[model samples]
Target chain A: MNPEESLKFSYYPGCSVATTAAESNHSLMQVCRLLGLDLQELEDWNCCGSSSAYSVDPELGFNLSARNLSLAPGDRPLLVMCPRCLHHLRHTHLEMQQDPRKRRAQERRWGRPISPDLEIVHFLEALIRFGLDRLKKGAARNLNGLKFVPYYGCTLFRPPALRRQKYYQAEVENILTALGGVAVTRTYNQRCCGSFLSAVKPELVTSLVNDIIGSAVAAGADCLVTTCAMCQLNLEVRCTAAKRLPIFHFSEILALALGAKDCQGWFIRHLVNPRPLLKDRGLLGPPRLGQVP
Target chain B: MNSQPMPAKTTEVINISELDHHFATEVDRRSQADLKRCYQCRTCGNGCPFVEAMDYPPYGVIRLVQFGMRQKALECATIWVCVSCHTCSSQCPNSIDIAAIMDTLRSMALEERAVIGNKEILAFHLEVLHSIERYGRTHKLGIMLRHKLLTGQWFKDVDVGLRMLTKRKLDLVASKVRAMDEINRLFLPYWRVKPR
Candidate 1:
């Protein structure tokens, strides 16, 4: 596939994106259609093990993620929507290539000769690779003056040297600007939101997410946009009402600007819905009075 | 028997340089992180979310490893408490991966049969693994329920759990993955390697 002019790639919608952040999945679907991006989800893919595997069993984490890569078709680079999933897949890819023992284990499990040739790219990477000029020209509605803090919660950019080449450090900011949204620079963008440990230690997550969201709110962001599903979840479930920062998936903002009309269900799914802010800004129409169900 | 070695008297001139010499090597072998590369710069702890909660901060963990304080580094609640954020790894001037070290410590604790300080968090990890073992995915509610039952934290997160359920975030039932047996096979090595 041509790297520059191509939009088609196999999509791996990580676990959280399907359940907790289903809105992200909905918005991503709409955005892909509007932008002419072809995202075919990998068939029969399993979990990437996330932080759970890394924190508990290193071996399980590697094998579980490698299993997914093994299942991916080599024809197209696997485009992942979640940063955690992207990191795990990519990290395991690196490990399996470098470690002879792990490489042997991976090849044996899959019953074939494996290759690190499986390219794993994050949504941000794909969008950035998709070209910003096209995004600006293709936007159906301008998100001008809509201040957004691009909250990159680890994964994609962290462990910097490993991710340095593949990821553009300012890619999220670039995407927001291209879509006509003002990216808040002063806000704490690249920080960890305690990720999945939020389930076990909500208090710790609350403090961490509070600081990240507070920075955005203080910087006058209308909403904090994130590419990570876990970051959105942590901010939604942990942050206090006083924080008043509605967490949004980057797909939601782009999908809206691309004129996604259906998916009121997606908007309502947010713990603190972004519609009121969008409606107030004239970026989105008023909520329709329709059936509750 | 206590796992720790006897501490030398403060009044005596203690030549402890040779003591715990193998600590750094053992941690290095497991973590694939060179503990000696750490220069006591607390950059990792500065960015750590759990530093206040940890007995020894990120740099302190490496320092402990450097001094061969295995009991100090491995038996504490910090390993369980760490979110594996990799903030330390990213910021480390030496490129020392603190997250990997934390995982290594957790594995060491489990292997050594050390008394874990944070049973609640431990229970949560075990329950999640158990759920994955059965369904081949981390069944969130099932893991939550099992964790609550195991830890007796029934009242914990009930409000949030209820809210998620009402919001339809929780998929109460899901079809088991067809290759669950394959996942089970993966766990076989984990079960057999334990000396106990």
Candidate 2:
């Protein structure tokens, strides 16, 4: 694929980004638009059988994910933002590839061709493949040496089933650094953020989230930029530490650096308001009268 | 005879006849993880973030499975506590997919109607699935409300819930897929209609 040409992808926002992390979705669209990446939202995409479906019933999980695959247009690669969604979609795709009978059965069920060769790529991977040159050329506002821990959460690249596939360990650092952000490595960057347990067992999640935030604060980082929207929510909502750092969806920072004007809308949604930190670093202007300070 | 009494026995003896010898094979087949390859190095347990909350560590659960302790393995809290973060599997020297095995055990436990090790977590998952079944997408507010109602923990996490609502993070209305029939059919095979 040509770096200069606009890349088209079928975007799968997943459930979290669609609802709870709407700001992330907004910022993601902003970033993609600035980069000239044309994202067509996957038509009528359903939930990817989140951790819940897979936990109680493996067959339900498989079928749930298979339906999303059936909906993907064979012409373009499916671009997913959430790591868990990416994992399930890609894992289901791999399973279908290995078992032709299952693939055919699902295809027949959906009355759509489940493409054997459809490429499932994460947004980060898509950026690496086609946006690096665009990022360097189209960067409007530098990151102002903003120090952030590139928190990939746990599911981004750690799953054993997808081990042999693409490894995205340093991709966040690579992209953010190119935009002038300083990457903080001396922290618990890849720690699990307690996932859905944040909902049921808030105490447990609070302790775990505190540990993660404490590590980041001790490491002297300004904020955490995460690839997963779920991690962003968990970290923001579950932390009970004395001092808290703002958690950013990776696309928010990317969109900010690209000179997105609607940043207030995005920053306002954060539990730990990032406006003050952004202002302190000269990344954002002083708030207007009556605006969130 | 010596006057000193024998120390109280701390270990429980397992009756070999009760062990399900095919349990390991069933898990292996479902999870696609080679349980036989696991030598109990304890790496998975050591790396698990939530191991401290579990009744048995990841390795201990694997040991139970290896020993065909089906009832013990199925009812363990480790499976429910695990969020499938894959930290254990990634750190395993033998490359055992310990998270996958945990997922399989959780499913088996649900299927066999074993006592749920963590009912609250299971309740949360059920609410999430229920939300998906209704709207074809998860409604965070709905899931939380239903979960709270089911667990009868209305006051717990109320502050965070309200905070999320104030921040407009939790959508009141869920986004739905246009193809509801397509999604509902997928859930038909396994989802038993439970009174909400």
Candidate 3:
């Protein structure tokens, strides 16, 4: 009962999150609520514009995105689960901070001063910061014999944009370990999944998705867990051929470890059914086939 | 009627209206500084793994855009061909954000009904976006079925599907709608407005 000891954060579920990774936001909301973490959603936020804007017009892209950064309600740090949003926000912050003139011009465009008061941290980092011991004790199901591939994609470390970092892979591994799952670190973990290719050249995406999936599958990982919605969608949906291998969002796993049954309630609708792996790991009780209940 | 060949001097007069200001606005909005920096070194094309199959290599399109030849640039398959790996941005000596700009162009092209070549790919993107709007996260089989149905390419990829099926790859079910109401409330507004 020391409720005061439980940490709370402001949640930012980006565009992809509200649409494509709804399960992640849902699961995160439920699991965090149960864990006594308070997450208040910001009001009237726009798309981070992601990597898309950087290539078109850097200033306008950053200005539009900076307006979003300016709109976050109050001084608390923003908790982001999407890696794309993380990259956008962090990159925007770094660029704005590095150049005073650019920052001032961006401020003029946004009609407001964009202060770096809010520190953006990924959910995986939050799990570690909250301490793995607590997460381990909270697990209702010990994920025994469950092997997973941690798909980092390209966002975790890129553009040499941010410093003050710990070992990214180790951080993710530590969190997974606390949840009773094993992480299989592989070369392709940090590689590109040709995420934007899903739009224009899917044949290329299909082939690239195959390679990323092949690497994970070959590494003997039963599924791929990631913090990026784009990576999750690309790996799970683009591989029309290998759709059986589930790609669980990190929020889903955290929800599971927190003993929230709602994850299973929503799990039924997952593109790639996770029952086979969950059953083998004893994560789900009994065999419930083709049933959301 | 016998057609008169245009004089060389007249050919030099560029029609600026054909430049696609909408696309230019989008590109300028996204890659303002970087777009002018591209110099057609073919580094972007050379680095792109899919360039060999593309109708217009990426670098050439940048050159076309720089020269303000709108129709020719927009008509090419370069935007559709880019994989958005950032290899070009990483390798470019001038710091051009080529891949991201390409994404913006595709988004604009999608909006203007200007899309050409790779109809199947366009269908897939729309399918995935639609699925997310409907269920708030794509269901693999649903996306595949929609993409295949819309493109009439279902049977074409059946071999890939079969191999995956034999290997226990494809799943036959959809994801659970645990908090369907919340998902609906959040997603409905965007679809109502339609993407621009």
Candidate 4:
């Protein structure tokens, strides 16, 4: 995937990626260059309405996500990283594919014809598809002995019946394997993180934070890695409110193995410092380690 | 000991007729797509962690709205309590988006200055957004201070302060984003007009 060549993906970096998780976006670009995967940022991409719109009006939610799905080029698979976005788009795609009446209702609501040909694939699957073994070969450094809990948090491989059949269910351990890291087995891997509760009712978020991080800590995980930005924000923010746990977007960890910098260059600033744990693990790379007075 | 007999006023306490006009108007203004389908199975109710602490349960809140009990529904603790987790929506057999409706309800209540209950929580919510408006992202300290100042609870949560201090969590020093001016400029209107 040459940065200059035409190896492109129809990328949908959701709202959070653009602003809050800028480092993940930057690292994604860096890894894309390293892997020679060209990403064409979809023009005029709108909010997938996240979980909000979907809850407001199911038809409206489907149409909004489908409208974005409809924007992808006919040839390329639509690439999305956020699991919430993936779940919503996948739900819409599956629903539209399975039912003509639902599709017609959505199309009528959207006031435009919708495309049925688009296939949505998450960035994790894309990386796996591109070959994790090859990715390991490209790693500038190994994540040796860095134990992490691969927190999937429900959305990625949820409602197992609907998700399993779609081949959406995956153990992130193999990707962890690619980085030469051990994925600690933790039951919180699929637990609910009390997602949107952080904004509306943070006290409940406190209990969820306790459980999620407590599970990872109990599992002896040195860190937490996830695919969704909302999950990342909730875990990181609530972790601050509760305890200090290092939670990273999966790509940030991947970027670390690629040796971009220790902790993805000040993105750690947004998080409560996880340096103490990283120090305990002796995994602190140059930049993060350098910041120690 | 014998329990005191209830006063006649207690039985006459259903002054809910006053709420009908407002409830009817609001329902007319908002979409009622699946509002009537709720059977109070409380699937959404059980999914909501906030329901236990709510003055009205999630299903009861919907029932209130459906019955045009606007004042009681708006005044219900569930409106302030819902965290917008979508667990309820996900579990809903009718696929009714109870959580988003909660958001719409909160916004409506704030717009109408109808926050008779959970004013502190509502103020905290607004203060959180105001902090974001000023800093582009939350600086926990700023939000806490602003919420405290607004709610007149500056010294009330001393135990919280002590814990944060012991944890080395409170940065007495200010932390800010570079675009503070632009961000604050963008959000000033919202803060100014937002319900106190």
Candidate 5:
């Protein structure tokens, strides 16, 4: 239990983090590395079936998540980034734990033993468990009193399926406040980001996103930070409000505070362009040559 | 903005003979939620963020299931419109897990070939599943392109699409799982074999 010793975790970055929210993935990696956490990507891991698989075929979604569980080595906790992925994985695990017959059938299907005792921890929980002191020691930059709303995007602690488990109500605020950022508590932090509706019903999602961003702006916050990558994407892409605040993935701000240097690449991927806000707060340096303004 | 008219409450008389008495039991078994405990407090409906878009509020859908109105429960736009954000479930005084009930109702709708209340939403989901089936992981750019083709709304979100492309948010190549056969076998269930 040495604080400085790197803790090993099998990381599962769901679809959004891998592609649409790669900046989150990049920043998460940067933050983890800075905090001396070793994240080994789960090998040959497939989709958790996302909301679609479960929506169309629940059994398919169950098996898809079970496959990822079977792949994880039981020795260490499996780390998940996406809130939806974490829910699906943990729900599947809970189901398997309740029904031995189902677990045995899945184990036979994959030809690998599914460990019932494997701990599935979200990145936020892992940071709280192992990285607080490390965060204190590794603080490389002041947050300049940057005010941000901790938007959990409806899935982190709301799902009834996992209600008995950990509730991450103020974990984001605690971590960021420790880093010198101010947490704005009056905004719509847990509002739905219109998940898939952002694509099918853009107008509806536009209004919802506008309401969320509008509330944040009204709360006198500098920006919004979210733990879920999909929330980050939906908030950025669907906002049609006359006033918009840049949405930062929790990892981006965490990485910036920990002195991650290659953040220009992450900032360029944002549609809202958080550079001005970062520059105003003095969290980011002045634009370098060839950097996007 | 595309909200449907609120469902007629009392204009439609309930024909008890037409009720499928076993529908509620089936949903209860599948979802493992205590639907019978819902006292119609409307706490769920009140807390639902997307209730404006749904024809029936969360409790109204529960009532449909309770009344054994199978077709109404399965074919209602509320089930499809729900993104399973669990706002209702969390706020429900009865702890009924309303979102799980919606999930069960959606799957049952697909299984029974009931008319889908929202075809576009179902189409978007199918595109995502198809991408997962092929790559073992969802490919955002591919899902979006194919979804546009299926819905034939290619020009609707073209600006957002272009913006994402410029930001390099969409990866051209999907990250695939190394074990393709194992991932493929999960889709062998006949119902899912034919991607709609």
Candidate 6:
């Protein structure tokens, strides 16, 4: 275990994580243990004020993220599982730095105003921080033959002003290599899958998601891996059994490579079955007593 | 944003006003995009996924914004239907964040009680905000039920919901964050965004 990877960091799981994506949360926790990483949940951390916040009131979004920023102790760089959280935090930081007047207002309002220079550690960045070389060498099992088309969705590497630069998408491919898997780069990977629209406009979401998944199928990917939980759910919900390829959170696959047993139990939460594919490929390990695969 | 043919246009003399000019400035201030920098290239309209559904496609909305046509722009479903995907921004030769500008426009529309072209999307956004205000995270099942009731679209995704319930993908229970008061403090202001 690398001593540097053992560094403790503030963790924010966002909202959907605790509720809808329990499997992702559990797998991520297990993977952290395997990597010798320490993740302490932010005490009384509020929502990052996702898409809904920004849509309702521009100022409200920044304020919501600012509240969390003030709550975040200076002990470690804040870690966020959701890319939307990463986007909101970075936006909040930049907006605060740009507007001193608003900063003062926030300070007076929060009573714990912070000159927040804390680095945001997105989950993908943390995986790379674990050192791709060490991860590949450390893998007890290799998903060598599996094809992964790493999906960035939006927010992570789009709208140039938000993301630091053109970084996360390429690092995702690198992480895929570290897992001893083939990353399909020849097709559409960075396109948005009509995220929140899955709730309001299912038809539009279906079409956009189809365009994304269609490109991956054409590129011969065995499975699609995503960083955003919203994207994971959208892709899975949009994909029918005919077009269904297991859309996995990056943490889920990382947990597998990090030697967490009972991948079946971890994936039981998925509506679209990933077990048949993983099991057929001889990756789920020998069947257990009472295991139904 | 792209180098392709644009949607068909209809000829109608656009009227601009003092208030309309002010509307453009407000949008530019809020979104930080120089509306004058746009060349009417129709690039953003070309790559937008929801263009077919939009009342005024991306470039059309930008043109309306440039002309300070606030009512015309807000009345169109284009702003609300945008998924904020940034495809247009990425393809912009002038480096304009059309998507971000769209975001600003939506917020302004909400603040003003302006004509929102998509009632369902606004309702959905409101429901989600309502959840986040109370629980600090969106309650998915709550949003679905509320949206269906609000939209009167019963039996929508019911089978999918059943499958999800069986799979335990949907959490029937809800939990609020420890700091509900703090969350409310952040939210109460936004709820009354409309003019007093």
Instruction: Please give the lDDT score for candidate 4.
Output: 0.64
> For model 1, how does the per-residue alpha-carbon lDDT over A8-74 read when each residue is reduced to its tens digit?
7888887788766788998999988988888888776677886777777877878888878877777
lDDT of 3 by residue, A108-147 (tens): 6446666755567777766766677776666666666468
* Residues A1-293, model 5: lDDT tens digits: 55443278899998888888999999999988888789999888888999999999999999999999999988788999999999999999999998989999999988998898888989987888775666766777768799999999999898898988877789999988888889998988998999999889989898889988998999998899999999998999999888889999999998888888999999999999999999887778632332211
What is every candidate's C-alpha DockQ against the true complex, given to 2 decimals? 0.47, 0.72, 0.09, 0.07, 0.82, 0.65
Chain A TM-score, structure 6: 0.91
Model 1 reproduced share of reference interface contacts: 0.46
Clash pairs, candidate 1, are: none
- Chain A TM value for model 4: 0.85
Give Cα distance to truth, residue B189, candidate 5, Å.
Answer: 4.3
Which lDDT tens digits does candidate 6 get at residues A144-223? Answer: 46798988887787765774532566887777676667899876687777878788788777877887888889889989
Task: Give me the TM-scores of chain B across the candidates.
Answer: 0.84, 0.89, 0.76, 0.72, 0.91, 0.87
Model 3 TM: 0.64
The lDDT of each candidate is 0.76, 0.87, 0.64, 0.64, 0.88, 0.78
Top model by lDDT, which number? Answer: 5
Off by over 4 Å in 4: A1-8, A54-63, A94-114, A159-167, A240-243, A261-268, A275-293, B1-49, B53-196
Task: Give the CAPRI class of candidate 1.
Answer: acceptable
Ranking by DockQ: 5, 2, 6, 1, 3, 4
Query: Candidate 1 residues B65-179, lDDT tens each?
Result: 7878777777887788887667888888988777778888998888888889677777777776777677777677787787788778799889888877877777888535676
Ranking by lDDT: 5, 2, 6, 1, 3, 4
Model 4 lDDT per residue over A8-116, tens place = 6789887566555656787787778778887888665555655544332344455557666655775677788877777777777777878878777666644556667
lDDT of 2 by residue, A1-293 (tens): 45443288888999988888999999999988887788999888999999999998878889989999998988788999999999999999999999999999999988899999889999887788775766867777778788999998899888899888887889999988988889998888889999988887778788888888999999899999999999998999888888999999999988887778899898999999999999887778532322211
